[model samples]
Target: MPAFVINNHGGDTPDFDGEITFYVIVCVFLTAFGGLMFGYDLGISGGVTAMDDFLKEFFKEVYEKKQHVHENNYCKYDNHVLQLFTSSLYIAALLASFVASKVCTQMGRKPTMQIASLFFIIGVGLQAGSVSIEMIVCGRITLGIGVGFANQAVPLFLSELAPAKMRGALNICFQLFITIGIFVAGIINYFTSDIHPHGWRISLSLAMVPAVILLCGSLTICETPTSLIERRNFIKGKATLKKIRGTDNVTAEFESIVNASETARQIKNPFSTLLKPSSRPPLIIAILLQVFQQFTGINAIMFYAPVFFQTVGFGNNASLLSTVITGLVNVFSTLVSIYMVDRVGRRILLLEACVQMFLTQTVIGLILLTDLKPTGSWNHAEALIVVILVCVFVMGFAWSWGPLGWLIPSEIFPLEIRTTGFAFAVSSNMLFTFIIAQAFLSMLCHMRAGIFFFFAVWILVMGLLTHFFLPETKGVPIDAMVEKVWKQHWFWKRYMVDVDDEVIKEQVHPHVKYVKYGF
Candidate 1:
């Protein structure tokens, strides 16, 4: 067991609290490994996409022979095959998020993560040794399931365990690792763009090594103390909480958790809570956030950054290097977001990002409308300008929607409905992500201008929706926020006037009985 040192990292605080205790950081850091896995899975596909020729050759006998058999296959089996291999994981993730609560509740968070790792192992092995494209697609689908659980569980795990003050930063740290993984994948793909004979396979297979190590390491750590307490393992729960949360005045904290648990347990199967009338508003917000995050065009840029560069007239090699730059911008900007989220606030950042994103998408669309193609081989200067605009777009997203989009759903819902709410939210994210990611290259392939206009419209609609429906969540405490934020219905009244929080509170808390209300 590691030494239990109180590092005051998360939750709201003055500077004097210093960082969270070393042990808490260590425990939290272990959970962040799940983010690393998420990031790696996200980036690996881009690298694999760049290795098209190598991948085609490796499965040559299968793809070439199959191409001849399927009469007039206009879909280009090679591209569809690649798209399916990449997106199958996300498709599975949509399914997995729905069931993640069962894994977390029955097996606990640590064991569920171990189970995810097992899927990673099997998925990677299938990809590395597959004789047919179908095999690779299946592997990706399994990987998707693992991703689904990790994506939902990791943030919920970290947020519940972290101090309220530090939670935003640490939670944002999860996105930081995601950007890091994307950066690393971009760099590896750039350097290996020319390497023949199974380069993409090698790139894709690196995920299994870390997954194995994390899986093994997970077994030794304590479960989420809060989860244990919820399960009525009070003795072990208190000890585990004290160890991870440090020897500070944990009495109030303990009581708060127990109270929350008791309140939550009244619902029994809380996973179905999202569909009930009381839970609909937050569910709408969660699903919209997920949809907006995808529709913001980040993944479109990420999965096809190289292709975008090439369309603007950069060479294949230069396009890959430009993608690396995009990844770097993502990583560094995400770090800035981690620092700023707790300081400046989530709402301010989100609004600013949404507007900025709208402008950038508009500009990119206009640039594409110019129909500017390189006269010669490649115009490095013009390409660089487009690359910079793409980075600016990325910067806007990293600060606001990218991490906060995921962050809000986890924090905004009542504990009673959080699991189901997140499942619906994240699954929506993946479902739209799957559609956009799969159809992205094909969309651009058919009509580049039309697709850019498609995203341009999405950005405008997202800006309107956020302004009308979403609440400001920065600095608010998590456990009671669902009640606190609901008293004011002006935030969401435009969307569902009939289901206003003020109207509901009159019924749920007659005379404002259970929770205190503020103007």
Candidate 2:
């Protein structure tokens, strides 16, 4: 164990270190299946919507428009009901997140994840057997609720279980699984697209595979020590910590977690506490990261990649193949993030990705604006160029914003409001995702090729804001974040008011001297 040292804030901060054990690895792998469910849904919806069979069954108008030889390419799939199939999930997720927060806090992370799996399985069943549009929409709403719970718990579970030094890499497993899910879903869609009248049903039914994995896996994994401790299962918490860390030498870390939990116990209403000036920095940062993440337009593209490719003049087979290629890029790029995030830090990846994504989006927009007309499709070479550019853009997003968006929010908040704060972050992400998924087809119709430019502008804004405002959280201990991160940051420091070292130390842990910020 590393020696405890006095931080510049005049608090004794223990260096809580733990070995990477096999048990921990297994737990993370199982918990991260939650991301697979989310990713499958994201990848499946667009491909299913683009399927001739699916559109003919539920969206007859879209089927007719698609068949029209002279139909405006941008407007053919801009039906509100079609958009609802994709967007309703996110809107339901947004509302369900608040409820998920309470369940995560009260029932613990493992139970919440199990609940997510159950809901997801039911949703999948509904979608697979649906005869009416209403049944499918209801299924989407139910699946959204599952997504809400999984999103709420998985990142937090990963963050809390991981060693501080390994937190970034492990938490990214959630995103890695998400990417893999998308890749798998794309492949499944490609194979199933030719299955006659029931192809879409086969695609929808397969989503239950991941949900079942999550459900069975949740039963096998141990509850996070932080959750156990917060719920006052101290003996079990310490024992579980020792087992996961693969060592019994966890006194310093255990005490730190207990101290943090004690502080959390004082605050009866974490939501109201979030309204305090001290809490505003993390709340603002968490919410803005989610909003900016969506405004980057990644989900819009993921949800409509096949449609977008077809709009650019690819045949059905070609469009599905193109989406698969991009999905491959997305999965591989996220592996790069998992490797580099802890080594190079979050801000560097994010800023670099912004530049890459902006350039690609801009070039793609210029190509479409100049060449592809409302009535004419791009020739083979120009269409290929657009596909390559989109893959480039997806690569940038997968490596940076995709994983870090979930990672940072899950790790930033103090234990007192961790779930509450993350709930807000999840809710914000879902809300913006709902907006984009619902409106992207319409926006594409109106803005034409300019829609890519719209996302490009948002990318530029995200770059500036990240450079100026986002703090580097690399190597900072989760329990000591207020003292080491926020207080050290230039702009966010203003929101953290100074309290007497002794008083703060006493409130957190009397035996170990550590200052806790008012925030």
Clashes of each: 14, 0
- Lowest summed lDDT over 10 consecutive residues: which window, candidate 2? 510-519
- For residues 1-519, what per-residue lDDT tens digits would candidate 1 score against the true structure? 222211111122211122367876776677677777777777767656655565575445424633343322122222565677667788899999888867776667787778878888888888777777778788888888878887877777777777777778878877777787788878877776777766677777777865776687677677876778667677677677677666644644554455555556667777566666557778888899888898888887887676567667676688888888889999999988889988888877888887888888888777766645322223677668779999999999988899898788888776656667788888998999898888876776565556667877887888777777777766655665544454456754343323444443344332242243220
How well does model 2 score by local distance difference test? Answer: 0.92
lDDT of each model, Cα atoms only? 0.71, 0.92
Highest lDDT against the true fold, candidate: 2
RMSD of each: 6.9, 3.0
Q: For candidate 2, write residues 257-294 as lDDT tens digits.
A: 87778778878999998998778888998999999999
Candidate 1, which segments miss by more than 4 Å at Cα? Answer: 1-19, 58-78, 373-378, 489-519
Off by over 4 Å in 2: 2-12, 499-519
